[model samples]
Target: MNGENAYLATLMELFGRANFETRRPRTPEAFRLDPIRRLLEGWGNPHRRYAVVHIAGTKGKGSTAAMAEAILRAAGYRTGLYTSPHLHTMRERIRIGGELISPSTVVELFGRLRPAIEADPDLTVFDILTAMGFLAFAEAGVEIAVVEVGLGGRLDSTNVVSPAVCLITALSMDHTEILGPTLAHIAFEKAGILKPGVPAVTAPQTEEAMAVLRQVATERGVPLWTLEGWRYGPEEVAPSGQRGKIQAPDGASWSIRLPLLGRHQWENAALAVAAAIRLREQGWIIPDEAVREGLERVRWPGRFEILREEPPLVLDGAHNDASAARLAETAAEVFPGRRWGVIFGVSADKDPMAILAPLRPLVERIWLTRSRHPRAADPQRLAEAAQALGLPGRIRSEVAYALEEALAEDIPVLVTGSLFVVAEAREAWAAWGRMPMPEVDPIPVRVGGR
Candidate 1:
């Protein structure tokens, strides 16, 4: 096995033996910050040692955090990035400079953290992972860390950091059970990361959500910069999916060429750039070249990622309504006038109709499939949902089968709506080691803003 694969195998075994989720899942309601605080205190408060940028939102937090990290790294900062819901391996959650933490490092950290885990057995899976990331980043001497909230920002384990800048990406309905049912409530939860006097950068949000964020920032005496005011025009779009740009914030302009795709990504890149400028204003030497270079070098997987070309296979993890809307918009721009064969799966908790409704018009045929996760929606149920929209589609039991059917249609195939589905598709594609016909190259675009 390759090094990464071998490391992943060992980490999974450790997680299983640790009974990582069994102890905390479906627990009594406790959104109090005390638990995580105590846990980090036990680890000697490693999170406090490094400067941090805390990113929170319903969607795009991971991509935004990643863009910020890449930009910081381009400016010669030793950056640490922490994100959840790993595509293939758990190690993908914690990284320094785009590489997963080493197997020895994982083993050592687990060894150090074992006593704490055994003592409180009630700590959640996310809590342990957050602690691991803090410890790992601290040990690696990371100059700055980009931390993505695991769930709602208010109670997420990563909330320990008093960030340099709190970045809230576009908020939408997601994790409603934990974050609250309404968009405003969810936005309030995300805005919990705002520390006193810490500047915040936000993407476009509903009036209600934006109001909550603005209120929170005001209460905390922090400045809140909205992305709508920072507009960027698409300078150029490469067939490989790169989009060049110029951002206008407060009548001041900065040129950037984002390596990621989609117009939504342009907004994301703008957010990242805005945040970087904020950091610079705070006396961090983030040059304009670093802003442009960092954006061009940013790598965020599974956001409109094209895994193969011939017959064009694309994958996007747009599991929520807002993200689905963005994915639909991107599809319209990238594959204009082309009807795509879509292979889709989503978690049972999501509003599948919200996802299916947007892509319905652009899709030629929809192949519904179940992702490997237990929470995956039943393919039959998903087909029913698609039919509810009066869209014609096929249903298959497994993702591989759905892919096969979509490939047989001899049209561009897009696998999306769930990260789990994308992960499974990537695993299958890698295992086969054979390129599909009409190979589509991944055009990386810049995602997330300052």
Candidate 2:
């Protein structure tokens, strides 16, 4: 095999023995940081060598992280971005200067990390993957690394970094099985990233959430700010992108053409702009022009993405109630008075009825489907749930067939529910249209409890 295939084969071998990311939560003992702490210490703590912008939230954290990385890169800083559950390839989860890590580099680093991983008992897929990113960033000599929390903040593998600034964006119901069901409980968990005397920022949140965040920041002696004081110009929404003026709390605003659509993105852009300004105050030298340029260049795949034209077919990974509500609202605003067909599937753990209820009024038809994920809800189960909720939908066991049926409706098209479904839908779309999805090396193995 060539270098790329060799690396992929090695990864497959390593992955066969570990747990998949989508499994149900383990006990808190399974989440202890000491293992990663020891592992990183053995590797010389690569995370400590660079500045970090750590982000955690129920929504928009990924977008905020991407925007911050782009802005810093536009300001001439060598930046690294680390996010989780990549859509197409694992390399997409880690990037330096917006470029995915090369295959040779991945193999080379694994040569070094493999010994430590084998010697340690507690290392899992996400733990080792996150460590690989930090080491890669340090090796590439990145000046700033923007890290997104893989799951809940407190015990997530990526929480080991002592960041220069921390951010939380648009908190709501998500990962409730692990993060707790109450809004305040979830806020407290995310706020665990706030270090003593470290500056932090939050997007506008509910009174319940803000109270918890404020109390935690005050107790930790951290400086906390909110985007509520920030403002943005009226957004001109389009199938391609949205144009709006992002205004910081300092009264500085930039007219930007954010390549992502939706009003939620506008709120996310404001958070990113606020973070850029805060970083500037810390002597980062980020100019206003870089902010505009970065916002235009930032690309976060699988979140409110428009894939095809002529009737505005879109893909969004809105898997929860709050996010589904936002997707429904955005669909109405963008394709007003028009019906659309939805290709929907979700995780087995999520409340399918809560997710599908809002989309009922907006969609003309729903082709309920299940992705290839081991934990995806069954299509028949989803159809039953939809019927119970009085939401109309039909079961299509195969994603390709579901897409074919939905597109045959001849209205605007949307593929949503879970990010996993979105990922599969994108791959199916690529095959159906002779397009290209990024090359991924997935191991053929038993998934859970293996």
Candidate 3:
């Protein structure tokens, strides 16, 4: 093997030791901030060195975090963005100034934390990566960092940050086994990120979720902002992007264009705008122009990403019922009545039927498959679920085979269910073209991001 491949494999081996993303824990106690806190403390508390905007929710948190970081970067701040479950490389989880973290830096950071990481039996891969992100950001002199919660906020490794602003995207039923079975229970976990006196922002939510959030914020004495006074004007959706106007609570409004598709993104953009406004209120120098420019330039791949035309090939990481519904809505709106063949796979923990149910009407056929992720659901199980839903398709053992079969329909094709499936299909398409498609960086790449 080449030196680069060997180095990448070494990194993978290091991360594989305690990766909960691949092997989920059965209990809630498996997630906590104490081990991460101790590691950060020993590293001189690097996460506290920079200002932070902590985000949490069932959906849209990654996009919201991306939007907020892009805005901050446009304002000329040395910004760090830390997100979870990347589409391609592990480096995509940590970025400085919109650039993926270098493999050498990851190695160096891991080396420094290895002693502490080895000593703690409770430490997961996320805990180590979170510490590395903090250290990397501090070492790079980052002025601000946008941190997305990896899982439920209360006990998540990323929840240790005392953020300047807290943002919650749309909430729904997800990670139910660990977080809880109800929306209120999930909201309580999400609301755990709220710090005393920190301003919090949220998208429109059901009464159940909103009540829990309000109660937690009230108890913590944190000011909360909702979309009650915010308004999104009519949006023009196109294959390239979408444009709409947002009216703030203060009677101020502005037109904004997002390169991201779906009406759901409009809601995420509104939350991001509110976050920027909250930051400005905290004496940040972000101007309105920065907000506009930042959001327009933000690029989050594998979410409604169109990989090809002719017979359009779209990729989306819609793992939950709510996000799956949004994906179906966007597909109908953007490509309307186009014959669609969906390639679907998901994590073993997810309810595949709930995800596939939304697309049943639009999809002419379904290609059931599994990504290479250890946690990916069995193709046989997925095929059974699809059959029960009255969606017809055969099972492909691998995502690439599913993509091949789906594309042969000469119709619009969607690869969805999990980010891992999307990543595999994307790479498969790129391989067929005799070209490389790396999500963030080209130097070092691997399969699983989560």
Candidate 4:
């Protein structure tokens, strides 16, 4: 195979293994960390070599992790960031100093990991990717890594780390099949990252979720910090970004500007600020200015991302009802009085009505579509679902084709539902506008284990 093909083949080999991200676990027991733990043991546990900030939540966890990594990086600390469900490339899951892990490095790391991978027939694709992230961080001499839990906290592969700080963003009902049926059950799973004596900070949560987290923290002897005394509010919200201010517990306040939009992101920023303060208390040398700069300059694409200006095109990865609600609110707030032509798609496992209901009032018409993801819901099914919700839409099998049709409308356009859909829309926009592509076309979406 040629060099590009070689890299693609290597990635395919890894994705061909059991993957829970593309497929739901059969039961909660199916998510055990034993295989990953044993696999890491064989590699000498590179994750233990660096300090970590572990975060888990139904929403905003990725944004919180990205903000924390940016803050640490701005403080001159070599940082590694590991997130999940990559928008474009598998390499986006692992980053050092805000750069994606190169394809060659992924190939090299997979080659190094192959022997152990072969020995353990039970390892999932996420398990292998988690191993690659830890090994890459160790190899790159990362001082601290911000790790976002791929799924629930307790059995997640990333939970292997004993983090310097744990952060749980605002919790809501999500992954009800895997985590549980209620908010408290979901909170219990998210609180699984809480280690004894490891201080954790949380965003504002429902009383049910907060109570569970407190019980878990008290049982684990983890000192948990809530955003009780902290204060934050958005000063301005615009298409480009938003300006916000936060008043931390210690009475120190910061005026911040964030590239990521939405009122929820302001909350995520406050949570990051709280986590950074906890890190400072641990003597990490993060200054006030670093926090501000990191919060301001942090680049988390695909979350309320404005991909174009005139006749606005917004892209967001709001798959769940709570996040979709936020996306709807933000979209309406930012582009007031403009009826939107929305291109919507989502995973089969998600509730389409719960997602579409939030956007109904804001939407004039929908271009129902499916991403290339194996788990993506059928567009024809989505069209029928949208009809039930009193919304009108036509079906499109491809995201680019859907976008082409949606943009032809004179109103604002929104491409959302799943990160996978947004990723495809992003690439289509880039291609149509002759913008630079990534090192490779997004890793092939024909993944297995579904």
lDDT of each: 0.77, 0.83, 0.87, 0.88
Evaluated against the true structure, the overall lDDT of model 1 is 0.77
lDDT of 2 at 330: 83
Tens-digit lDDT string for candidate 2 (168-203)? 999997777677879998998899899999899999
* CA displacement after TM-score superposition, residue 33 of candidate 4 (Å): 0.9
**Which stretches in model 3 have alpha-carbon errors above 4 Å?**
1-6, 434-436, 439-450
In model 2, what lDDT does residue 81 have? 97
Candidate 4 Cα outliers beyond 4 Å, as residue runs: 446-450
Can you give the lDDT of residue 421 in candidate 3?
A: 89
Q: Write the per-residue lDDT of candidate 1 for residues 1-450, one digit (tens) a residue.
A: 765465454455445432322222343255455666777899789998988999998777888888899889989999999997777656678999777886667667876887777777556556777888899999889989999987778777788798999899888887776678899889888988999989889988889999999998899899888876666756676547655665565686667666677887777777888889889888899888888888878888788887765667888999887788888887777667768888988877777888888888788888888776656778888888888988767888878778877777789999998887887777667656754422211211111110
Give the lDDT of residue 292 in candidate 3: 88
* TM-score of each predicted structure versus truth: 0.90, 0.96, 0.96, 0.97
Clashes of each: 27, 0, 0, 0
Question: What RMSD value applies to candidate 2?
Answer: 2.2
TM-score, candidate 4, is: 0.97
Q: Tell how far residue 415 is off in model 2, in angstroms.
A: 0.5
The root-mean-square deviation over C-alpha atoms between each candidate and the true structure, in angstroms, is 5.0, 2.2, 2.1, 1.6
lDDT per residue for candidate 4 within 1-450, as digits (tens), equals 666887888977888888787877768999889999998998899999999999999899999999999999989999999998776777888999999988889889999899999999999998999999999999999999999998889999999998999999989887889889999999999999999999999999998999999999999999999999888878898888888799977789999888888988888988998888888888889899999999988998889888777789889988888998999899888888888899999888888898888888988888999988879898888898899998878888899998998887666899888888888888898888646764444465833211
Which candidate model has the greater TM-score, 2 or 4? Answer: 4
Number of the top TM-score candidate: 4
